[model samples]
Target: MLQRRRLLLLLSAAGCAQRPREPSEAAAAPLPAGISCVPFARALSGIALAGDAHLWWHAAAPRYRRGTVPVPGAVLVFRRSARLPQGHLAVVVRTVGPREIRVTHANWASGSARGQVAEDQSVVDVSPRNDWSSVRVWHPASGTLGVTVFPAWGFILPPRPADPAELAARVPVAARLAAGTL
Candidate 1:
């Protein structure tokens, strides 16, 4: 039965009438304001997705302010670039929210909210209704950390599994809670 359900989910995601579930619909909790992405990444990592040591979040950066009151399960996404404070981007891991997300960015020393055009800490309201998926079945989705960002980055990629079926089993949870289920 479990295998059948997983297979169905995979099919629904990749094919079939069931459209791919949006990333926002998979969250099972409400996000509060001031819930920065850095902390969100730190909190969501390992818990929401699989274990990831690369997604590190720090409070009070040597340059920027860390997550003062971040919630668990938020995604710390940013523009794939070299600078941190300037193009820092991320998503709030909630039970329910928007089908798609838009981001705004600026540099660190000049990233003032004066224009009232907040970038990283903007638009965290409850999501509207949509046909988006309630759960996201991802095995290992890592952020961009290529040479564009890391000057001399070098890390060994994981080996392919001998048993593809078993490897698929190692992926994250399939049945994500409905928005607000958390």
Candidate 2:
């Protein structure tokens, strides 16, 4: 009886040791005040891709693979235009469907103080060609999708970590985000 109880306690302790750490400790650290979208998305994805948000698309070409589809942890890079002089960056939270995805980004809420971060917001691809070349982001302040369809450079799937299998076995995004890690 004593041996059986000892074995059971050991097993429980081992299981507890394998539990994942909270995002606040293991995930990206919180952004500093007045930081732009580029660093925010980079930190959120645990990726090292750098440069201005508008230039990430071109900069990532040699270092990371670019794609048109959004993946859960990929950074969506927006193109620079007259309205958006510097461009934008957001992390894809999930794929809502064909031509639609949910994202989390910082400093996007208009007229709100600077460096406002919105989580799990909606973005719809509106490119006429069925590609993710253009999108309309959910405007939190306006309470509606923005009338302007912003052009995107494309989605940049960040380089996978050294341990791909470990990433596959990690906790789901929703749970992490709810835990404030993502």
Candidate 3:
């Protein structure tokens, strides 16, 4: 009986040794399936926006902030109206990967080089050092969609916004595209 108990205790110790570590200690860790939009973006980008300025910073710049905002990069979309995506605010979320993140605000947007203001601001990237905080994103190649972030001046009429459900619905859509490749 003593020998059996010793073996059982030894097995328990070995099992405990295989336990996973905390997330904070695992920066750049490969995410589990279906993580939130932000962590998904950071892992792909290789670089994330970083700073303590009460504002946003984008690494994946999108072309427009209106319509169905594109994906898999950082960008800003602005608006001055209250129409169905006609004039609104949002941040294009994405990274080097082929996914999209769409976060918008009625009166908030910030940047690293720019200051904060209230004009339905959207588009901002958080520092990767921030552990993907403010890192906007959607899904990856799992969905057949892509977007290109661009300079604010050359805003394009964005596609329609795909509800989280619709994006997950698996409609036949394009896979990869450039900023103007629309």
- Of the candidates shown, which would achieve the greatest TM-score relative to the real structure? 2
lDDT of each: 0.24, 0.61, 0.24
Give the 10-residue window scoring lowest on summed lDDT in candidate 1.
150-159
How far in Å is the alpha carbon of 108 misplaced in model 3? 20
| Candidate 3 ranges beyond 4 A from true positions | 1-34, 50-55, 58-182
Best by lDDT: 2
lDDT of 1 by residue, 1-182 (tens): 68656533432322111111122232234223222222222222322221221222222123232331223223333322333322232333222234332222111112221111122222222213232211121211122211222111111111211232332222122122111112
Residue 86, candidate 3: how far off, in angstroms?
A: 20
Candidate 1, lDDT over the whole model: 0.24
TM-scores, all models, native as reference: 0.21, 0.69, 0.18
- Native-to-model Cα distance after best TM-score fit, residue 153 in candidate 1, in Å: 9.2
lDDT of candidate model 3 versus the reference: 0.24
Better of 1 and 3 by TM-score: 1
Candidate 1 segments whose C-alpha is farther than 4 A from its true place: 1-29, 47-86, 89-182
> For model 3, how does the per-residue alpha-carbon lDDT over 91-180 read when each residue is reduced to its tens digit?
332223222234321112212211111111123334334323223321122232223222222122223333433322211111111001
